[model samples]
Target chain A: MDRLSVPTSRPLTRLIEALNRMPGIGPKMAQRLAYYLLRASAEEAQTLAEAIVAVKEEAVLCAICQNTADTSPCTLCQDPTRDRSLICVVEEPLDVLALERSGAFKGLYHVLHGCISPIDGVGPEDLKVRELLARIHDGEVQEVIMATNPNLEGEATSMYVQRLLSPLGVKVSRLARGLPFGGDVEYADEVTLSRALQDRHSL
Target chain B: MLGGTRLGEADRLVTLYTQRRGKVRAVVRGALRPRSRLGGHIQPLSHCQLMLTESKGLDVVTGCQIIGPLFPMREDLVHHARGFYLMELIDCFCPEGLENPALFSLLVDTLEHLCLGEGGERVLRRFEVRLLDITGFRPELHCCLGCQQALEPVTNYLSPSAGGLLCRACAPEQSPVHSVSVNTVKVLRLLREADMETVNRLNLAPDLAAELEAALRSYIQYVLERSIKSGVWLERLRREFGPNGALGGPQNGR
Candidate 1:
């Protein structure tokens, strides 16, 4: 049965349809959220709407790293205390946030925004790769750490970048693979376990 | 499976090719988290059996088991690129919900060959020819498309725009045609008709392999009306690593 045909009020139906379009939200969830908003105070609804609008209106892609920021070049790119000699390359702005949350990497970042995925018609030219190369050519960067995801597209993107950086004579490396923190080794997949074993370190 | 992207925090949108359904996109819930059982069975280039539940838009993958992960392809960069290239070919040519068992088997066979350490150039050329055949875009190799005469055991022209080979006498009429050697012609014919087992036994000279690759790539580009992305990456790998660098050394098995 169509959620739109539920005989709801016009404003309520509109809200349900809009919420249904969001990721991971089904018609049932959309309707539930719509009802919650319908009963909430007007100020609560206005604040939510305003936050969405503010994000779109205020967010800009940082010039150097291509991450979303309120200001151009972003705080990470402008920070003089951060190590500029090492650049960690990642696939998205969200990945930068995840890495930052871990607090393990203190180097600067270059967000490619996406990986090379032919299934989606995304290629090297479609990504921010040219900007990355330009940065390397114009800066004093020595090592580039490929921190793309562990998926196939991610691996390919890192390899693609590695090949391009090879000609520039800069040291290029990928993030070490191993068991995640707090994860049991017995439950790990064979591929990940094998990679972790191959990349094991000496105490 | 072709590949997938992380959907939400723990879910994934996976692209799969099946014998019954040509290509499918499904959502696998909790595929990203460490304890998710579905994560190991759906890696890109992996062949798997999936139990899906039909939803409003995309199907949901409820259960999965790995049939073949093609793990070696992932371990090596060149093999990995070639594997992705094969998947991209299917993704580009095959439409969703259309049944194509032959194409599906061809893909599985090619990936299996790659897993066995078969040279990528040979496997890719064979794959291209078979793909064109299954898709009804097989180019005429025995005779000229324009003059309709049997091609001689000499150099000929392959016209991508004309969709087949042209005799030397008729070559000038076509605005653009690639000069193809008789050896390349014979090899293409063999690949189109032979099984993977038979094709695997044959070894192509490097020059012939290069010629065959160029001709088929041009033909495929014309058919799709654009160049394939993986083909561009393969060419880039060739240019950067030399012929043997990324794709591995040429196999000369008789």
Candidate 2:
């Protein structure tokens, strides 16, 4: 029998179910969260609810890079110090945050929203690819760094974009693949090991 | 086995084709984060042995051991595209929860051949014929679909719409029947029953390979009722790589 199915108020059960639907939240965790919310003061519950509502109502996709932002052009795109001549193409908004955390890339970013996966029925047309092309055509962009994930679909997406950008005179480059910092060679797979060997640098 | 997709930040949803259970999608926690233990093993087309823990909706991938990642095939653009096409074809044709060890072995062998740098067109043609055979969609190469007569050693038509071959006399006038040469028909027949060794030894002229590819692709399209996406990428890569392409070229180094 499901633990959540035990006698409970309708509103409490509803909250548990809603929380259960979220990623990484199982029934047990959902029940705990729901009961915790039930015990919290009304003002605390109202604040949490209002924050969720505000995020949906206020957060918008930036017109330039398609990243989630409160304004048309995100702060990264509008920032005067960022390199305007280069663009880093990634798969999702989360990737934008990951790259930003690295503090390595100073160029602007274009989120494709998703990768090209035929099994999932996601194609090039489904992504924000045309917008990227248009950005390249209309802007002073000279180089595009394909920062899509290091997977099959990611490689395919980067190659597809590279082909499209090749004739347009934009120098296309993919992120360098090697041993991740602190990654042990003994545990590295053949693909990663081979990549690391091929991309080895002179000290 | 095919690869996986990132799920919920640190987790990965891997799709595997098992001999006993067929296609299984399992979630592996902490697969995407740095220093992930499952990172190197569950890559796309890795051919790993997975231990799954049953759960509601989707199973969790608890353990994995890499048998073969087919790294060489993944390194080249053309080969990678072909490998992707093969995986996609299997995923489309084979339904979930259906056990067919023969088909599983066929996939493994075909992927191995692709990694070994065998002629891609021949390997693909052989894989198509064998896949159709296992799936019960094998086209009749010897007899005519319309008249049931033995096909003459002349130019005959392979009709996708009719689900097989048609003789010159039985072929519809305006229908989209692909004309196949005597050599093409013979090669297709050879691929159906022959092992990879036998098929590998047979060198196909560029024109014949193209003909075989078109005919088989049409039949596959007919079977699926929709166009294959990887096929489009394969065609584009073929054009880019040229006739002699990157079949035996230097590894693409990922």
How does chain A of candidate 2 score by TM-score against the true chain A?
A: 0.93
TM-scores for every predicted model: 0.82, 0.81
DockQ of 1: 0.31
Which lDDT value does model 1 have at A109?
Answer: 96
Which candidate leads in TM-score? 1
Over the stretch A46-153, how does candidate 2's per-residue lDDT look in tens digits?
999999999999999999999999998989999999999999999999999999999999999999999977556577889999999999998599999999988878
- What digit string (tens of lDDT, one per residue) describes model 2 on residues B48-81? 7778899999998877778776887656666767
Candidate 1 runs further than 4 Å off: A1-38, A78-81, A182-187, B5-9, B19-25, B49-63, B95-102, B135-137, B145-148, B154-164, B168-179, B193-210, B221-227, B239-254
Shift of residue B228 alpha carbon in model 2, Å: 3.2
- Fraction of real interface contacts that model 2 preserves: 0.28
For model 1, residues A57-115, the per-residue Cα lDDT tens digits are 99999999999999998999999889999999999999999999999998999999899
True contacts kept of each: 0.30, 0.28
Name the lDDT value of residue B222 in candidate 1: 87
DockQ of each: 0.31, 0.30
